[model samples]
Target: MKKVFCIGELLIDFVAEKQGSDLSKATYFTKKAGGAPANVACAIAKLGGRSVFIGSVGDDPFGTFLLDVLRENRVDVSLAQRTETFTTLAFVSLAENGERDFVFSRGADKELQYNSAIKSEFAGNLIHLGAATALLGGKLEEAYGHYFFDGLTKKSFISFDPNYRADLWKNKQQNFAKKCMTFVEKADLCKFSLEEAQLLSGKEDVAEACRFLHEVGTNIIAVTLGASGTLISTREFQETVPSIKVKAVDTTGAGDAFIGCLLQQIAALTNTDSLAGDRDLLVSMVAKANKAGAITTTNYGAIESLPDQEQLSA
Candidate 1:
């Protein structure tokens, strides 16, 4: 199988299961290995796919835990960097029905920057961007180019997940929408939550939003809709795949797992790059991905609850 190169943040998530969303009245936060890209890498590894993660973490207990989780799941961490900065932390609030809200305390994840190694590793790999940290500026934005746009464009296929979080962009740049569209245009396959697709395309209709994205240059667009299922569209055909119902638990990392599962099949398949003409194959891939995502809600934590190949095959 070809390797999937995941770029972005790795953080420690502090989760709390409460009777209600009112964290002010209730109590307790459970620490877990979180962060979207990190969870995606773990999901890939657990499904018997190869994934390598590149990012920076602090020299702290949280970082140690994050690294241990990734290594335990069989992810290659050679490109991960360590510094003295404090590790990033997210406080997750989950409701009884499995819906979630987050309070993030950005730390070392913001410090991940460009390096020559990203270019060297880009060839023949499927690159995934988005994990809360990739949108940060400074050397990191430049690094995105060295790897995705410039260095490896000719050799590898690109996949993107905007994973937009409204909370993080409040104090940032004036051109946030512009930056997102720029990256969307470069991806071969891209997935976004319905909320993210609207935010990026400025179109409320999911299909219209996806159409705009494709017109702008994204080849394959998949928009996730919680339990209702996923909307998959290529330049050829579009379909909505209904999700397999499951007992709900934690909503965290479900979308990331969906992306991971999709990439797992793509990287393992020889015709992955030619997804446009293979409508039937594409539909099946998205349907399988939808199942992987729905199953994630049946468990807790991102990495801890990811379904393995045996469970998936069964």
Candidate 2:
């Protein structure tokens, strides 16, 4: 089986359930592990897949808890690093329609540095770039750039999720847009929410956004349309995945679960089949992944609500 390497931030999220997307009058907050890459790693592991997470965290109680959380989900954290800084944290407020608002603090996660751990990780067959803080033009950029670029020529299925954090960019809109676009151009499978797709591509229209992304070399684009399902577009094909009815309680980590389940399915392919080989197969996989995402929303927190193989296969 191919190993899945997820490179990005590892942090804690405090989620609050409320009547609507507004967080002004939230009742209570529940803390849980989060970060797009970490969520994907957990999702893949839940499906009995070999998954690894590569990133840095503060050597604090929160960091330790995050490490334990990853290991508990059967994700490999040997490549994960820890520092003496404070761990990153986010407060999320969920609405009745599954929308969420967040207040993020990247104290230590901003200081996370990439090192010599993943020069050989490209052989893992899949590498997912899903963190907003990753391409912040630091020493970590050079480190991640080396390995990510190296993966370009290797036998790896490169996946990308522009898990854009508006707060991370702040006022550097031009710089952030450039950085994400460059990463998108490198991925074999690209995942984005409608907002991210529009923001990254600067095109509000879905068809145009997909076309623009494809022209930039992203062969497979998965644009998540919230409750409307997903738009799976390839250079040669297009697919719109629909979701099943579910009572969503919290939307935290739903997108990551979708990607995680999608990767788990791809890892089962015995041959050297590319991810964009068949449109029908990709649609089916996305449908299953959609269910995985929807299932997570029925409960609180992220990993705490992720569906296991039994739930998904049922």
Candidate 3:
């Protein structure tokens, strides 16, 4: 199987135990290793797939803890970097329905510098760009663009997720959408939430949104629809794959798990390029990914909630 190189932020999530959206009122908290791309990396490794995490963290205890968690999950962290800046932190509050509100304190995660030596590793591998802070404009953004183009030049199987966080973008939604299109237009596979699909494509209808994304050049598109399951689309057909029913305790990393599972399935294929034409195979893959996502919601935290091969099979 080809290695999946997941690029993005690795941070600490201080989650409030209270069931309320207001972060201010929340007193007690629990620290968890969290980040969209990092979660995806752990998801792949825990499922017995070859996964590598490529990003930066602070040269501090929180960063050390995050790296330790990834290592314990069997994700390769040799490519991960550490800086003198403080580790990034996110304060989260969850509602009763598993929905969450977030506030971020940006830090060393944005300081991931590009390395020319790593460019050769992209060949015949899988590259996943799913960071919420990737496009926020810094060294990480530059490194992201470099890696993306290098992946394309090396014929890597590239996957992208906008990983849109409303709290981070605030009034910059238009800018965020514009920046995301650059990756969406060239990614081999693209994952999006229902809201992301609509916002990026400027189409409220799911089918139309998929069509728009296809026109822009993504060969395969998956739009996550929560309990309704995921809508998988290729140039030839579009279908909604069903997910197993589970009482969601937290929806934070569900999407990451879904994409991670899908990517791992793709990585194991003998011919990754042929995925777009095989409708039955695509449906089956998405179905498994749906289960991964649903299972994640049954627990708390991102990496800790990811299902392994045993859990996925059961």
Candidate 4:
């Protein structure tokens, strides 16, 4: 299988141990390694896929622990960098129904500087632009663009998930919509949550939103519909693959798990071109990925909750 390269933030999440929606009422919290791209990298590795994580974290205990978690799961983190700044931290409060409220202290995650030399590292592999903060500017945003072109030039398959964080773009929805599509237009596969789909395409209907996204340029578009499952679209096929039913506990990593598993499956195909053309294969793959997502929610924390190959097979 071709290695999947996940580029983006690596941070710590301080989750309220008491499950309730209000962040103010929370009395205590627990720290966990949490970041969308890092979660996806760990998810892929846990599922027996080769993955590489490229990003930066502070040269602090939190950063060290985050890297340790990734390494423990077998994700290649040689490209991960350590910075002098503090590691980014997110305080999360979970409602009884698994919804989350967050407050962020952004730091080292934004310091990822783009390196042209990394272009040679992605040949015929997969590059996933799965960062919520990458589009927010600074060196990380620059790296996001460079990696996109690097993937193009290296004959690598590109996947993108806006991983939209509403907290980060509070009053900048329009700007978020505009910048995200630039990536949507370049990706081979684009993943979106229902809210993200509606926001970006200006279409409330999932099908219409997917159509708008497809027309823009992405070869395959997937709109996640929470418990209803995922709606997948391509020029040749479109269908909703139902999710595996489970009693979800924490929904934090579900989307990341879904996309990570799907990317892993895509990496296994010798001819990457089949991803855009194979309907039955893609459907089967998404169905499996849906299960991965469902299973993830049955536990708490992103990396720790992701299902392993054994769990997935069973």
TM-score of each: 0.95, 0.93, 0.99, 0.98
**Strongest candidate by lDDT:** 3
Worst lDDT run of 10 residues, candidate 4, spans: 16-25
- lDDT against true structure, model 4: 0.91
The best candidate in terms of TM-score:
3
lDDT of 2 by residue, 135-223 (tens): 77665566567657867767688888878777677898778778877778878888998988888788989878999999988888998
Cα lDDT tens digits, model 3, 1-314, are 99999999999999985468888888888999999999999999988899999999999999999999999999999999999999999999987778898999999999999988998999989999985999999999999999999999999999999999999999999999999999999999999999999999999999999999999989999999999999999999999998999999889899999999999999898888788999999999999999999999998898899999999999
Ranking by TM-score: 3, 4, 1, 2
Candidate 2, residue 235: lDDT: 80
Clash totals in order = 0, 0, 0, 0
Each candidate's lDDT (Cα)? Answer: 0.83, 0.83, 0.94, 0.91
Alpha-carbon error at 310 in model 4, in Å? 1.1
Worst 10 residues of 2 by lDDT: 110-119
Off by over 4 Å in 4: none
What is the TM-score (0 to 1) of candidate 1? 0.95
Clash count for candidate 2 is: 0
In model 3, where is the ten-residue run with the lowest total lDDT? 16-25
Task: For residues 1-314, write the lDDT of model 4, one tens digit per residue.
Answer: 89999999999999995469789899889999999999999999998899999999999999999999999999999999899999999999987778898888999999998888888989989999885988989989998888998998897899999988888999999899999888888899999999999999999998998888989999999888889999989988789999988887789999999999999888888887777788888889999999999999988788999999888888
Find the number of clashing residue pairs for candidate 3. 0
**Listing every candidate in turn, what is its Cα RMSD in Å to the true structure after a full C-alpha superposition?**
1.7, 1.8, 0.7, 0.9
* Residue 132 C-alpha lDDT in model 3: 97
